[model samples]
Target: MFSKILIANRGEIACRVIRTARKLGVRTVAVYSDADAHALHVEMADEAVHIGPSPVGESYLRGDKIIAAALATGAEAIHPGYGFLSENPDFVDQVVAAGLTFIGPSATSIRAMGLKDAAKRLMEKAGVPVVPGYHGEAQEIVLLASKAREIGYPVLIKARAGGGGKGMRKVEHPDDFSEALSGARREAKAAFGDDRVLVEKYVDKPRHIEVQVFGDNFGNAVHLYERDCSAQRRHQKVIEEAPAPGMTPELRKAMTDAAVKAAKAISYSGAGTIEFIVDASQGLKPDRFWFMEMNTRLQVEHPVTEMVTGTDLVEWQLRVASGEKLPKTQAEITLSGHAFEARIYAEDAAKGFLPATGTLYHLKFPDTVPEGATMRVETGVRAGDAISPYYDPMIAKLVVHAKDRPLALQALVAALRQTEVAGSTVNAAFLAALAADPDFSKGDVDTGLIGRHQQALTEIAPPNADIVAAAALAASGAGALPPSNDPWSSLAGYQHFHPAARRTRLHYGEHDITAKVSVRPDGRFAVTLDEPYGSTNAHDLRAAPRLARWPGHVTVFSGAVGYTFAVPDPLARADESAASSGSLRAPMPGLVKLVRVTPGETVTKGQPLLILEAMKMEHTIAAPHDGVIAEIATEGAQVTDGTVLVRFAEDVHA
Candidate 1:
């Protein structure tokens, strides 16, 4: 094995690679940008180097800088951990030219699968079943539209380069094909610098199943079963599981054999994933699955495969890169228990899954169970770390394993419920709700599952009475009250002569909760809540509730969700009012990609007003109601969250 290696990435994947390298007694070097100077992965590495500025283009994407850092640190090899430079064939060639081992597939293998259209043609030559689509080289808009017409309506426009649901769109009709193509090309250009796209027939009830394949220089390859990545949002995988819930042995064997065949055909070395789109409207079948694309690096959900197969894919990568033979033959590998991995992201599900940035004040994962011994958390962040907008907003990947699919799923739900994350907007509640979803629990999953159940999953239910009480206890001085010799000072709301009540007010979104708390004569506390579900309650002053406070915010983990209440200062609340101004504010901090309205242009409700690109996704801000634009922000402007993007006439209501 190599003595030292450089992790050419950031976030959890970097940390993940570091862990496996350290176990092999290999020293690891971490590269970071300005935004991640104090990042968790940097602190965990044996040595760290500052590459460039915060923006990924200036740092992570700078292959020259990364190569220099690796050479300077005397790293024998470089591990491109999934995202930035993982699939860059040019980068792989550069690493090889620098005389450093690239801990992944060769440049030829990467190139074979770099462009979707070309990869499809390549797969077809290798006798691998590929989706029926327009894989031709023509990029003209009219040609693409005609191809969509030939395929049928509801065709998918996918970027020729890059993966992870970027630069992809689904058009439901011929009329929408032009607009979808334009959007797809623009996103493709912005994301992958390749505006070319391929039009493919959209599969009905598609289920994403990918086979994990590994190879060595000795021309040996094997498959590690498969992962069902059907539960998705916005075409991105959300929750993934190993040994697909309803996958039969025959289907699994067929898919794995095909995946291995693809790997051997390219003389693929190291770890790679062969993703297939399965037509599951009927059920899993050998002939119903078709090749989607090949990811030429370690996957984000590799842990699920590791849990079920008892294999460390990173370890396999290191061994193979070191010129070792395949760890195990196809017949030697065996599947064990089932596993699930839920990606926890720092996003607000209530606000359309908008990416959020904040310090993680309180972070906790579920305790490991005896039967779920393989349960683990893969993360590169801690409680004090900030989720920066310069990178992916993923918080962590929660993985669990059990004897069967049902047990594994149950454990996953329990773990998601027990997880606590504060000091930022998270999708914890949404994940918990999804875990308990009746349809999900039954394994009736597909790409459209989340979109179909979006309302229930994103609903922000009001806090119950217990949550209010917990917020009241934390907001009041009771929890932090110091011990005093004087009886009046010892108790909260104590009086010298007459009884008095201390009022505590807290804000949860738009609602205000006021609690009238007073110390009874016997030293017990009497609490009364105002408005809505008004009720009188009693509590002992000796116990403190489980709560976390960060400046103006207090969070209480009630039920499966953590409720955060904003503690507005009484002095500041006086100046606040519900100002019904005719303004449309930016929902999140992002770059104004396009401004569609002018000073006097009239727009109807739901009309395209502007577009803001943030967290690697484009959000189109629509007209709230019929209005005449009086002012508008400029295109290409960087705006903060809540910044007014458009101002309308006084007569218009937003």
Candidate 2:
């Protein structure tokens, strides 16, 4: 095995690689941008090197800088962990030219599967079943529209060059094809620098099942079963599981065999995934599955595979890159138990899953579970780390395993309930709702599951009296006071004849609540909350509430949902101008990619006015109502959160 290797990535994947390298007694080097200088991965590596500024164009994407850092640190090889340069064929060639081992598939193999249209053609020639669509080289709009009509309605336009749900769109009819194509091409060009796309027949009821395959220098390969990533939104996998539910032995054999065949067809080396889009309108069958695409590196969902198969894929990558043969034949790798992985992202599910950026003042995960189950949290951020707009807003990947699928799912739900976070909006509650969903628990899932039930899933219930009382106590510091011998020290609520009530003001969501507290001799609090409906609710607590109080905020976790309250400053003035202004502000810090309207242009409600690109996704700023644009931010401008992007004419009526 190589003595030392450099991880050419950041975030949890980098930290994940470093852990495995350390286990195998291989020292690891980490490369970081200015944004990740104090990141968890950097602190875990044996040596660290600063590459460039925070922007990816200047740092993580600079192949020369990464290569130089690896060479300077004397790393024998480089591991591109799943993103950035992982699937870039040119970067692979550059690494080889630098005389350093690239710990992944050969450049030829990557090129064979880099472009979707070309990859589909290659698969067809290799006798691998492919989805019926237009894989031709023609890029004319009229021709593409004709092909969509030929393939039938509801076709999917996918970028040939990238993955992760970027540059992808589903058109339901010919009338919407042109607009969807424009959006897809623009996003594709911005994401992959390739606007070319391919039209494919959209499976009505699809289940994304991908097989994990590995190959070695000696021309041997094996498949590690499969993962069902059907729980998704906008074609992005939300929760993934191994040993797909209702998968028969015959179906498994057929899928795994085809996966191994695809890997060996290109003389593939190291770790790769063959993703298949399964048509589950019927059920799991050998003929109903077709090749979607192949990920040419280690996957983000590899941990679930590891839990079921009892193998370390990273260790396999290192050994194979060192010219070793396949670790085990197909029979030696046996599936044991069931596993599930839930991706926790720093996003607000209620607000259309918008990405959130802030400091994580409180972050906690379940460290202990039941005896028969195991819980693992793969994260790169700590309690005090900041989630910036420069990178993916993924907080962590929470994985759980048990003896059976039902128990494993139970453990997953429990783990999510036990997890807590603060200082930013998160999707933990949404994940919990999905995991505990009736159809999901019964394994009746498809790519459209989340979409079909999004409104119900994203709806957050109002906090009960206990929760509000907890926040009020935290805000007032009434439950956290030190014991005093003198009764006068706690006389705030005391009266000559009877106990008096002291009121504390606190802010929750959008309303300011006044909480009345009366202390008891037993150290309990009689709390009364003034409800919004001109009524009062009271609760007498038995003990101190479970919560975390920061300088200006307090977070209370109730099951899987966390409620954060702002402890307003007593002497600070209130500013509500932004809330009442007729302006559209950027929701997150990002680059202004396009200004769709000029000043004084009229737009209708929900019309696209501008595009803000952040965290590798484009968000279109839309008109809130019929109005005339008075002013607009310039295109190609870097903007922070809440920066005004478009202002409406005050004289114009909606």
Candidate 3:
């Protein structure tokens, strides 16, 4: 095996590669940008080199800098762990030219599958099933729309150049094809510098099932079964599993064989994934599956695959890159159990799943998560680490495995509930909802699972009455309401005139809850409420009511959550309008990359007029619609909380 290798990536993927390299006794080098100087991956690697500034354009995307760092560190091979420069053929060629091995597919192979149109054509020739659509080099708007009409409505326009759901659009009608095509092309150019797109048949009920394929230099390749990545949001994968939900033995064999064929046809070596979109409306048949694309490096959800196969794919990548054959034969690799992986991202699930960034005050997974039972956590960031907006917002990946699909899902749900992350909004509750969903539990998996019940899935976890009462008691900082005469003392629960009941309001999003506390004789107050989720009563008026506190501290509540109200000399007050709406805000900290309109431009409802790039993905902020843009508040600025993007016209004025 090669003595050393360089991981041409950062964050979790870099750490993932280093782990396997360490297990194989191979030294690993990590390259990082300025923003990730103290990142977890940098601290874990044997060696780390600072490549450039924080922005990807200046650092991670700079092939020359990465190559130089690899050579300086004396790495014998380079592993492009997805993203950045992974699929860029020039980087692979340059690494090979520098007398170092590229631990992935050959540059020629990548070039063949780099473009969507070209890859589809190649797959068709390789005897792999392909989606029926236009792959011709026609860029005219009229022609493309006509072609969409010819192919029937609901054709997909996808950027021929990039993945990650960027530069992809689904047109549902002949009328909207032209506008959607232009937008897809624009995004494609911005993301991959390739405006070319491939139009394909949009499967109504598509299940994304991809096979894990491994190969050696001797043209020998084997498939490691398949992963069902049907649960998705905004074209990005959120949850994935191995063996699929409704897989037959015959269908599994056929899919695996086709994946192996695609890999061998290109003389593919090392680790790669051949993704297929299956038309489940007709039930999974050998003919119903179509080639989607090939990921040329290790996938993010690879741990679940590892759990089922009892093999380490990264170790295989190193072994194959070092001129050794794959450790397992086609028959030797077998799926033993079902596995699942939920991608835990630092994002607001309720608010369109926009990537969020914050200091992780505490981040911990469940210790009860089974070891041999298949629950695993693969993450790089730890407690106290600040989640930066310069890259992906994924904080960790929670993987679970079981003897059967039902058991695996049960394990997954328990793990998600036990997993707790403080100081930022996460998708934990949403993932839990998915794990416990009856439809999901049953084999009704598809890419549309998220969209089908988006509201219910992303719904915020309402504060339980017990928890709310606990927060109130913690906020008061006393076991009971201190007597007004001796308010500074800790023991007073009730005083003169029926215990001086006070009213405090809580505001969560657009909803409001009012709690009226009547200090009781037993140091516990009865709290009655008119809450958005309905009224309830909560108790426990002790100094520290319930043990929900973290670290060495307990939180007295504040605002809607309860701010600890210490029994000091005096207190403050609030008004009726304090619960009303403030200005429309940015919601999170990020860079305002583009402003699509000026202050006076009139726009229709849902018209996107601003773009923000945060958490490694671009987000377009739109006008709510049918109004004039007044007080447009952003333009390529680094904004923080409450940075208004645009205001409504005069009618919206309060």
Candidate 4:
């Protein structure tokens, strides 16, 4: 193996590669942009180099800068972790030209599988079953629409150049085909710089099962097994598991054989994944599965595969790149147990899964595990790290393993419940709900599971009296006081007549609440909450809810849910009336991609007015109610969070 290698990526994947390299006594170099100067990956690497500015185009996407950094650091090879330059064929050629080993497949192999349409055609020639679709080169709108009609209604338009649910759309009818195609093309161009798309038949009940395959330069390849990524939202994988549920021996053999065939067809070397879209309306059968696309690098969910198979894929990549033969034959690699991986992202599931950006005031994960189970957290962030708009908002990946699927899933749910985060919104509760979902527990999952039950899954119960009292105690600084030995200090609130009480004001959601707190002689707290409904609830507690206090906010974690309350300043003026104003503000910092409605144009509630691109995704700003647009932000405008994008005109009477 090479003595040193350069990781040409950022975030958890980069950090993950570094850990494996360290295990083999290989020195690792990390490259970072301005946004990630003090990132955890940088701190963990043996050496670090600054590439460019924070934007991807200026830094992570700059192949020349990355190559230069690798050469300067004397790195013998470059490891492109997952995203950014990982799948770019040109970058692979550049790395080879620089006389540095690229720890992945060759440029020819990537090119063969880069474009979805071309890859599908190649698979068909190789005798691998592919989805029936329009894989032709024609780009005209009329021709594409005709092809969609030929394929039948409810077709999917997917970008030929990329994956991860970007630049993809599903059209239910001919009437919506044009609009969907336009949106897909625009997003594709923005994401992959290629607007070319292919029309495919949409499977009603689809399960995304991808086989993990590895190949060596000696023309030897083997399958590690499969992962089921059916639990998804917005066409992105949310939870993934290895040794797919209900996978029969015959079905597994067929899928793995086909996957190995696809890999060897291109003389593929290193790690790659062959993703198949399974038509599960029936059941798992050999003929019901079709090739969707190929990912030419290590996958984000590779940990689940590693946990179950007891192998390190990164070490395999290193050994293969060093001109080693296959470490073990197909039979030597054995599957032992089940594993599940849940991706924790800095997003708000309550508000349509909007990406959130903020400093992490407090961050934590489960430190204890149940017997016969193992828990691992793969993350590149620390407690004080900031989640900015310049990169993906993924927080971490929580992986759990056990002897069986039921115990593994039980451990996963418990781990999620113990995880805590503050300063920004997260989807912990949503993930916990998804893991504990009845259908999910029963293994009845498909790509449409999250979409079908989104409303119920995103529902979070309001804080009960106990949670409110905890927050009130934290906000009042009463929870931080130490136990007193003196009777005078403990009896300070004792009065000659009635007990002394202090009121604290806090804001929860949209309502302002007043908490009346009184200190008892027994060192307990008596809290009375005044509700907006003209009701009062009282609670006496010896212990406060588990909470973390920041400057102006306190977060109380109850099970998988976290309730954050704002400590209001008593001297500040009240401005709650503006909550009803008909103004649409940007939820996060992003660039305005398109403006669909002009000033003075009438729009109904939920009508798309503009689109904001942020965190590598597009968010559509819609009208809050039926009204006439009075003021609006223009296209190509860079906006920050809370920036008003559109305002409605006041109603006038003649």
Predicted model with the maximum lDDT: 4
For each of the candidates, the C-alpha root-mean-square deviation to the true structure, in angstroms, is 2.3, 2.2, 4.8, 2.3
Using TM-score as the yardstick, the better of models 3 and 4 is 4
Model 1 spans > 4 angstroms off: 370-373, 481-489, 536-545, 573-580, 651-654
lDDT of 1 by residue, 1-654 (tens): 999999999999999999999999999999999999999999999999999999899999999999999999999999999989999999999999999999999999999989989988988998999998998998888899999999988899999999888889999998998888877887888889898999899998999999999999988889999999998888887799998889988888889998999998899999999999999999888899999999999999999999999999999999999988988998888999899899999888887788888899899888755464458999999989988878889999999898888888888878887788898888878887887889889888889899999999989678767667767766776646543345486454556674567788898887888897666555555577877756544454233455788878899875458899988787774533435466888877888987878889989999998888886778889988997888889999998878888888863443
**What is the full ranking by TM-score, best candidate first?**
4, 1, 2, 3
> What would the TM-score be for candidate 3 when compared with the true structure?
0.87
Model 1 pairs whose backbones collide: none
Judging by lDDT, tell me the better candidate of 2 and 3.
2
Per-residue lDDT of model 2, residues 1-654, tens digit only: 999999999999999999999999999999999999999999999999999999888999999999999999999999999889999999999999999999999999999999999998998888889999999999999999999999998999999998988899999999999989988898899888999999999999999999999999998999999999999876778899998998988878888888999999999999999999999998888889999999999999999999999999999999999999988898899999999999999998987788999998889999876668998899999999999899989999999999999999999999998888888889999999999999999999999999999999988888777788878766876656544444344435568755566677888888888887666555455667787523232234444455778778888888898888888888887775445367888888988988899998989999999988887777889999998888899999999988978888973233
Which segments of model 3 are wrong by more than 4 Å? 370-372, 476-507, 511-583, 589-597, 602-608, 611-620, 625-627, 633-641, 649-654
Which pairs clash in model 2?
none
lDDT string for model 3 (1-654, tens) is: 889898889888888888888887888899889888998899989999999998788999999998999999999989999888889999899999888999888898889888888888899999998888998888888788777878887899989887988888899988788777877876787678888988888889999999999988998999998999999998999889988988988888788889999998889888889999999997888778888999877888888889999998888888888899889888798888899999988888878998788777767787785544656688879888888777788989988888988888878888887776766668888888887777898989888888998998876555556556555444334434453333324234446545665565544445554666655455445566665333333443333332333332233322112222122222445454433132356878777877888877888877788877554356778766487777776676888756766666664444
Show model 2 residue runs off by greater than 4 Å. 482-502, 532-544, 576-579, 651-654
Pairs that collide in candidate 4 are none
Q: What's the TM-score of every candidate structure?
A: 0.96, 0.96, 0.87, 0.96
Candidate 3: C-alpha RMSD to true structure equals 4.8
For model 4, the run of ten residues with the poorest summed lDDT: 532-541
Candidate 4 per-residue lDDT, tens place, 11-64, comes to: 999999999999999999999999999999999999999999999999999999
